[model samples]
Target: MRPILLSGHERALTQVKFSKEGDLIFSVSKDHTVCAWYSANGERFGTYKGHVGALWTVDVDPHTRLLATGGADNTMRLWEVQTGKLLKTWDYLTSIKRVEFSEDGKQLLGVTEKRTGQLSHIVVYDIDSNPEAEQPDEPTLRIIVDELPRVTVAGFSFLSQYIVSGHEDGSVSQWDAKTGELITNVFSHDADMQVTDLQWSADRTYFLTASKDKQAKLHDARSMEVLKTYVADTPLNSAAITPDPQSYVILGGGQAAMDVTTTSARQGKFEARFYHKVFEEEIGRVRGHFGPLNYVAVDPTGKCYCSGGEDGYVRVHHFDPPYFDFKFEVEREAASQSRM
Candidate 1:
């Protein structure tokens, strides 16, 4: 596979996501800017620039016309995708770490962090209402999760019935999206490790969690049972499973920030690694990034995937057709062997 390198961010890239239509890509960075690009050719469209502080996260609505972003400024802002005009802003008492739109684009979810008391909160807002109407004084649902470890990442379920959050202490919690009630919490990893990222499978039957404990695990979404585990030499920062029929798990990570300078640091461990979703076998790896990778996202077509890195660059990789053809053959072979 050949990667198309898109570089413009002056600082580390925080997140990168493809639009629902898979025609556009959005990236946010510590440089305090969010950029839009043509995913097909890696051409720059324009940069949205109103954040006063370094941006931590961004999300595109289901309709792909509105963009929501939050950052160190303790504010969440909505912008029009076509004009890059700031449409609305919500100010909070703390910085926002992550933001996501519900599957139906009716609600917005955000995780806010307060440095003073090291407190965290999950905020949900009604985004589908008339924009011209007066705004409510408070969010639709705001829950203080201060008792649990700091939340690192969160996302809505496929049907938007629940919100799942990964915490710094390697725990996963499910919450009622409508009522802000806690459903259940699972200790996914060792007590000392941190859960860095969580992603639901394309079928929504299972989800994957990447942890600082140097492992990625696949779990049954309903029962929360451990289905499989992929271990690495270094902590995993992010992971994603390709859509059904050709399901493959892609993981990206490397040595922790402080361990990067050590003499024992393993070379090439930062490359993106691929594994068979069913058999849990390492299939291949893609090498390009010089620094640790922060996130990985597969487009809706599953023909290409994107990676954001601490090196301040986003790489879009389009796979050759033969790659998928070979995977299909392998799947058939595995099935035949299992039946015998």
Candidate 2:
């Protein structure tokens, strides 16, 4: 596994996104710089400077070939990927937590902090127009919900035309990506723990939510139902659903197992299980990391994945390799045959 070193001091990496070609990776750091890198060689590409505060999230629109970034500055900026030129600065009255582009790149969807007396809002903006246009129009609609206790918004997924926003309160909502209509709010255990990460399966039929409540859950996107939930030994902050969506890989950092004895500093507990159609069963486990994992992302091919955590290290794991372990076994078998 190759490690890609990144800049940005000791600040938390809020978001990491891959370009359409998957050759370049862009990460927004608490240091307030958007650093791009060549994934293959771990070479630095370029950096974009504009945000005064930490960049909270970033999304790349495939059709327009533009990058949209949201920040703690209560604004969103659009940039040209190749040139790193700032195209536009979008202003909002609230701090933007999550920003996403539509399937066609004609619109932008976001969730923001609730302002005074205002409930949480899901907003939609037309990309072709501007907030400061000659005849500016307000964002299409606002869906106000019970305010989120935490200011952080986990992430959003665009399943078909519906937008799923996972909040810090362990609640997931389905919204009309175009109209901002509230479809359904999915509730599993009513734990009220924060949902730190979320992802929709490749087929968009089911989605996964990882929470600090010590569980990773799967929900039916169409019905907003909790199909299954896996309990972890410790608080789970991050998880990933494989492309197949039949299994899930979850990170508990230093979560202790049922048989764990000593509390070593080693965060050596990671688990991947095959759930869903198999009635939610545990399939595999690994004690892979030496520190609590901060994030886990599966590549497009589903043949490999990456993880980064509090240890300030990133590691890549190959799921499939045709020639792995040939040397040791071959030598052992040759010795045994010779002795025979």
Candidate 3:
């Protein structure tokens, strides 16, 4: 597969996501702005601007008509996707690290870092609430887990009844979204290894996590048991699963914060690795970025995926027909051998 490079951000990209309808791509960057583009051809649509500080994350609602963004300005804001008009803003005491919409689009979740640095909180807002009505002083649910290390990534479950979070100390926790009650906590990696990203499978039966510990793991979403582990030579920053039935995992990462001063330095440490989900075999790597890749997202159809990096570039990679042909052949061979 060849990557179509999309360049515009003046600083590192923090998040990249394809719209639910698969027509547009949206990305947020340390440049303090969010931009939209045509998913098929990489044409720039327009930029969404308002934040006074660097943007950290973004998510689109299930309908793909609204967007949510979190930033160092200590607020999460909602915007209309068509005209880029700011819809609402929820202020916080510190920088917002992540923002996500529930599967139903009726709720929004956000994680923020407090001024004390060690303390973090998760807030869930009722998106279906009347916008014309008086805005509440606080979120519908505020969850403060003092026992957890600082959170790195978080999202709602497929049913939107539970909130799952990954922490700086390599732990994973689940909580009741409505009651703000802790459900379970599991040690996922070695001490001090941060869980950098999390992605759920298309069916929501399993979830994948990437970590600073040089590994990406697949876990059963219900049992919370480790199902498989994919090891890498360098620390992994982001991971995602294709929506295809024969799902393959895509991951990206590198040595932390290497200075890219020369041609060779630019070529090193930024590769998107592919792995077969069932067989756990490495397939291929896509190399292009000059710095560490920070985010990746697979399109809903599973024919392509996109990556954002610390080098301030977004790349969209579409698979060649032969790639899928070869993958299916391997799957068939494995299935036949198992039946014998």
Best by TM-score: 3
Q: Rate the local accuracy (lDDT) of all candidates.
A: 0.83, 0.61, 0.85
Best by lDDT: 3
lDDT of 3 by residue, 178-289 (tens): 7989888888776789999988886666789999998888887767788988888778999998887646898899877654454364445689998887777788888888
* Cα lDDT tens digits for candidate 1, 1-340: 7799999888878888888777788999899999998889899888998999999899988688778999999999888888897878899888998999887777888899746775889988888533444444468998889778888888888777888888888988888877888888899787869888888776566789999898899877666678999887778989888875567899999876566666332473778998888788888888888778888888866878899887799999988886677565666898889999
Q: Per-candidate RMSD vs. true structure? A: 2.7, 7.8, 2.6
Candidates 1 and 2 compared: the better one by lDDT is 1
Judge candidate 2 at residue 136 and give its lDDT: 20
Clashes of each: 0, 1, 0
TM-score of model number 1:
0.92
Distance from true position, residue 302, model 2, in Å?
A: 2.3
Off by over 4 Å in 3: 129-137, 258-263, 328-330, 333-340
Each model's TM-score, in the order given?
Answer: 0.92, 0.76, 0.93
TM-score ranking of the models: 3, 1, 2
Which pairs of residues have clashing backbones in candidate 3? Answer: none
lDDT of 2 by residue, 133-226 (tens): 3322466655565643543453345434677777766777777765657777666634577776676565556777777787778887777788
Which segments of model 1 are wrong by more than 4 Å?
Answer: 129-137, 261-268, 328-330, 333-340
